[model samples]
Target: MAIRDQSYQRYDGPVRTGRSWPVIGWSEFRAYWRFWRTKLTIFAVWLLPLMYALLVLVEAALMEPGQLGADGPGHSHLNLFVSTQLFALALVYIARGCGIVSDDLRHGTLQLYFSKPIDRIDYMAGKFYTLVLLGVVSVFAPAVLLAGLRTAFFVQSDMLAEIVVLHLQTLVLLAIAIALLAAVVLGLSSLTRRTGWAVLGWIAILIVPLIVHAVGAVAADISPWDRLLSLHGLVGLAGDALMGGADAMPEWMPRIVPFAAIGALIGAGFAALNWRLSHLEKIT
Candidate 1:
């Protein structure tokens, strides 16, 4: 019996160093886009903005010069689209974020990740970046493009300044919405190793609030503060405040409540994520 000597040989390669988070984020981002379903969903969602823009153009073409006032059909349509699209954005968040961390845990990939030069924060940040980018592409980018297109082709000269201001406000609101939703989904993902459980948790978090809010609305003894119980309602209120539509919120419900609720949700999510990851790190 002859045994051949086989020894490990060290090969020279680039030593990975600081700020590998972007590389991690980029890899995930590219991987997601490779899936046909993801590509299709993104295309469909982005088409919405174009459809709204076309509606604005059609309305502008058909209406008389002075008839299309500041509060015209185009304006109303844009506002409605922005408000109604939150649910779609939520779906995007769930689809992309629910499995990100849980998959790592389920497949025992966390050990491999931690064995590398990456810190837990960097790993979390990488996942967070991917989610945030997906949210922006699915929701924020489209809305901004729609606003710009409307301004370029449909807005009246006198309304340009006002429309631009509204667009900026919408951008801010969309950014906040994406950030908070991403945090919630990532936190949920960290809490479970099964992607299905994480998804179910996200659904419950979103839907249960709506159900409670609906029941409160129908009850005769409902308190004004009960409105805050609805996460969806709070998001709407926050959007209203951002767009200078504070009159839409209840007189008793202060404008700050919605912003505060969003802040609290984000904070709680981060805390949960930290706790879960820290425990996992200790175990490893």
Candidate 2:
């Protein structure tokens, strides 16, 4: 029989009953931060954003006010900066998110989590919060800050409000994009216990669709709308449209198609997460 430690006393501490997810989120966030890969990816990704900052400074100082307007390339720079971070985003997702759920399951940590007052929803919320926070810091912050910097240095007072509104709209769009990606990453992470396989699964999810779309476009001469299967393509089209850049979609395809594709992807991700949760309930 296992010996019991009689020296341990029952807790008389205050039973605080507030949201527990933030604690779980911060804990997971710290764990990810300790990884060398996470640190390196963050350091490397910030360099491009710094260059974009310098470009913004020069353009704001020298370019004509009209060039920074609604139809200007400045907005594209903002979108482009975020797009360039997608590689870094993927790296970070692999570093931290790929194992977020699987590691817990593999090591039997969920039992510990469930032993506490935290429900499955709170635990899932923490996981979502961690990935979303990563996305915001790594992708959303740079893009939005550049937008703000442009608005501050370049815009005339009369057009200030309009620019703010446009940039805010773009920011919200980017945020939605971040959340969608987070959901997909977490959902995929739950499917396997091995981090390596999770990473491969994530890669396949992003790449296989494009390969299929490419084959169809070439062999069947499919319409441009078929790109809805390509995650990268859908995001690119959505970003350009959200940035109010020139429309990237075909005239035949509705503007809503990319957004709808994003919604569908998010729904699929949630389905995966719920399926995993159901599995956990069955076993535990």
Candidate 3:
């Protein structure tokens, strides 16, 4: 009886096998790279970041030693580096993210992806890696090259440690900023398939908070902590951190505020992305 039951269970119904995890991983990785290549072909991803990197090199080459001040505004390669990194982050986010989801939908590819065996989490994980990879390559890569050149050319033993620490700090901050920006832009783009509408959405997502802060900075005189819940607020906080590290801003708070805001923004953006993916399933 036991032998008969075992055989019966084996033949009870047809079994469906899912795609192997390794294959899925590879496929998703390849898909991400494909998207990246397509995006990179555009000028902003390739040309703009390169130009920005060269700009950093130029400015660093121009910097004279012992000119940076402890309390006053002056030229510093470190300041230029941070500022350039921030600008690069903004450039990549606005350029790449504007079309990440919109183009897929506009091209009618998103529906096919929805029909795949992959879950929303897996898809999102892939998207997250893709965005993070681009950020690393575009922002951190240039910063590293410039820092190396500067350290080799000018920095002393004492300044070397500071330069290393500053590079690490900038890397962490840039990663979080770019990742959060990607998620928000991708989520909004997914919600609406039109590229024009997506670009409009991106602007609205970024601009509204600045308008609020401008009001608050003028009237309320409160900590801009409330602003972090929005895009501009979060970037503004990160800017403070970058500027603080470069001695461009007054010293009062820890650099942790920007890190914390990045964490929260990324968390919220992922949650929203998950919601969008779930909705995609319903429609498909």
Candidate 4:
């Protein structure tokens, strides 16, 4: 039985069989829901989104008469949409994502989780979905619901198709924004064990760049489109897509440039954050 004993000793640690896409996806969703249920109360989770939806409804109500449609040719749906998107979506992402990973580390949760058979990717997947869901509840769901309400209350044949198209466009735009926000927040949180620092660092990473960009804009005579590197500018561009306006950009640059650049920053930020966190060894 010496051979049998030797064989048993050969593999001492937990064995990992990496998961497939479908399994990973479902696991992510399920884990996210579980965390959501536990962390957020019924009222906070449901009420917050509903309240944001009402804000959009109020904005629709306040819009000038006959201004909902595209017939003006000087139409400005993009501005309103971008503003609402930023206001509605930013809080949820900032709160949950900024705290998630850092809290795990500070409270010794990650060690407990790692002690189980779970992988870093799985852990990150769960956190990512949680942030995505929060964004949907706040920004996406509210935007669509409010848009539908607007279309129902004030129907205009000329603008209805455009509004509908804009609504569809919002889904894609919000998805990118939410993904970027969630990924960067999660990655940053993972870098530090202090939740407060994680959040502040996130804000600094986001805001400081824009502050620098703003100074550069004036000193260098930079075009507004170039300022899209600023946090507010990128947020505004995302909003503009929904509102159908982007006057700040140079007329020569294609409309897609701002949106694309914002998306790239978010994507790159997420990758860098995740790479940093994933490589981190536990501090005893």
lDDT of each: 0.75, 0.76, 0.60, 0.62
Ranking by lDDT: 2, 1, 4, 3
How good is model 2 by TM-score? 0.85
Cα RMSDs of all predictions?
3.6, 3.6, 8.5, 7.3
Per-residue lDDT of candidate 1, residues 1-284 (tens digit): 33466666698888867877787777888888788777777777777777877887897788787765546323334445665666777777666668878888788887887788888778878888888888888888888877787677545567777777777777787788788888888888888889999999989988998777678778766665665665566666787666756586777777888999999988887777778778876445
Clashes of each: 0, 0, 0, 5
Candidate 4 lDDT, tens digit per residue, 157-197?
Answer: 47666656666665666677777677667667767778888
Alpha carbon lDDT at 237, candidate 4? 66
Please report the candidate that would top lDDT against the real structure.
Answer: 2
Q: Which candidate is the best by TM-score?
A: 1
Segments of candidate 2 deviating more than 4 angstroms = 1-9, 64-77, 212-222, 240-249, 281-284
TM-score versus the correct structure, for each prediction: 0.86, 0.85, 0.65, 0.67
Clashing pairs in 4: 77-243, 78-243, 78-244, 79-243, 82-239
Which portions of model 1 show Cα errors greater than 4 Å?
1-16, 70-79, 154-156, 281-283
Error of 3 at 284 (Å): 1.5
State which candidate, 2 or 3, has the greater TM-score.
Answer: 2
Model 3 residue 93 CA deviation (Å) reads 3.9
lDDT of 3 by residue, 1-284 (tens): 67756644346677566533344435544554566544563335445446655765776567665542223332244445454555555566565556555666667765777677766666666666665665666666766665565555435434566556665655565555667776676577667667678778777766676687778788978574665557555555666566455354335546677667677767776776677666664545
